[model samples]
Target: MTYKLHKLLPAGAAVVAFATMMTNAAADQIVKIGHVGPLTGGSAHLGKDNENGARLAIEEINAKGLTINGQKVTLQLDAQDDAADPRTATQVAQKLVDDKVVAVVGHLNSGASIPASKIYSDAGIVQISPSSTNPAYTRQGFKTTYRVVATDAQQGPALADYAAKGLNVKSVAIVDDSTAYGQGLANEFEKTAKSLGLKVLSHDATNDKAVDFRAILTKIKGENPDAIMYGGMDATGGPFAKQAKQLGLRAKVLAGDGVCTESLAQLAGAAADNVVCSQAGMALEKMAGGAAFSAKYQKRFGHPIEFDAPFTYDAVYIVVDAMKRANSTDAAKILAQIPGTNYNGVIGTTAFDAKGDLQHGVISLYNYKAGKKTLLDVVKM
Candidate 1:
């Protein structure tokens, strides 16, 4: 609910850690972990939050002086900027592979992560994504790919159920950015919403780069749907929301994890208030390391933490801990240890199922209230 930041120690410490990683590789050692995300693009803010969360975990684990396999090892986090672009993500991942990281923490968006994941898997590296919810990632049968957050298949339906039951909306319009994550979620929502007896008015699509939504909004308005659901990240989401409102569609807007970031609120302005969004993890207001991480993040970055930060933070720990538990950083060993993991994460108990899915995970609905996306409620499955 609140945030505070401690004064940052000089960047010299990280420089020293990087030095240690370059020269030393023995006992009293540092375990280098690489995390990649769109650190400089339209979704850059979300990527920074994801990286910060991972850094916070590394700092905490190092503070604990965690002893694993009878070695006093420290955690060292190496972050890469993927720019939210698929090709750039692959390049960042290749750099991480060359570094020979004990494990990899991310490729935040599905579009970027999917291709980068192929690189990691081919390199025999274990990768855990906090935000890449596209089902195709796990279905690929690559033992190295795992997801910390629940899949879009789960998130889409939870929002669909809310739109049908709580909002009592009969006609719903669907829109998506056509990215792997966006299209996957939009498809799931459309299927589930229609199965729930709601009328599917108009199904439209957009790209992350396209700005003008007047035509789609006009069509949706003509359809007179009770609500509009968007399947995209905040970058496109904020504009879509603002445009929808500006075009006088007025139908309640709903979206999945992609649109749950704070930047969306800035884009939609007052229009953001009426939009209902669903996210894959617990709200920063209520989670295992929620408050502490938020405070630390604000101190370091001078801003509030985004919604997906906890999962990213926990994912870092999960990869490191699993590697340590496996006794060897062999990709197969680390990958095998992920299933049925029960580590206490910043988001609470972290566990994965046989299908490489989080077991009994939770999803939450957020309403932008008082200039914030407060946790309206949670839906778990």
Candidate 2:
């Protein structure tokens, strides 16, 4: 996967510039942060969004003389790409550990975040993810792991409920990308759909690079389900939606945050029209502080990174707020400071639940119509 780098630096410079800043900041009074995500591999777009979001925020904070303990402080980020793989994610975490960052914001996909989280937690680092939505990640009892997005339990089941109860669907088939985010969400939807007495007739798995899903759709069509639910992101889900339509599967397709991106509409084209996708957090252009953040991102990156870049922008600021409140850069101090954070983030008013899950009771249901995503409803979590 190719990365869409921010315009703050020359192209192909995200890792070098960010790592150098993290290293050089020791000479200056800086609140150093590390952002880990897939800068390459199939999930590169998400990683780039995560990395750029932090860089943009930290740059602004430093320029504005943001301070801690009455002393103006510079903010820096050590951006590392995990390649969206577990082993690679662990390596990224180690890179941050080597840099000794004050806090972290990253690992876009839930799979990478889960294993990489143990590294941060054991080392007494505060990690706040901007977009991971798996429930098990938070349920693992890690005090330092936090996320701004609602969990798959919240997003996946709600989508399933809507397909079964709200949309008046009787039966559904499901597909996953064999990723933690994908499989985990598929499981939640399957369980919930069963609880609601909706028939879950078929379930299958694919991967990020899969370009052909006609076989899966064909198998699903055999079940004659009213809808087909997918547990994956736009990289794969977008193509899946398109393939399903091309295969003559007319059943509505429903998906979770993993696939709720503006890019999906383009990937699926006319086939995306009427396909439902749900996700946590308000869209980048719809949330508070959206226009400003969007303009800033576009100005810095020459293009938009992803739909939820502002949430990452907010994630870095949230940690910065904690650093100021704690009056120290100690990881423990910042970790403890996270819970009561009612930061006026670009996404919305963000506060953490007892489990370190962002009280983002804000989940939106969206449908692609006429090449645009139409917001159907906002279900407050």
How many clashing pairs in candidate 1? 2
Q: CA lDDT, every prediction?
A: 0.83, 0.83
The list of candidate 2 runs beyond 4 A from truth reads: 1-27
lDDT of 2 by residue, 130-176 (tens): 88888888888989888888888888778887887678999899899
Query: What would the TM-score be for candidate 2 when compared with the true structure?
Result: 0.89
Error of 1 at 311 (Å): 1.2
Candidate 1: which stretches are off by over 4 Å?
1-28, 329-332
TM-score of 1: 0.89
Q: State the weakest 10-residue window (summed lDDT) of model 2.
A: 1-10
TM-score to native of every candidate shown: 0.89, 0.89
What's model 1's lDDT at 191? 91
Tell how far residue 109 is off in model 1, in angstroms.
0.6
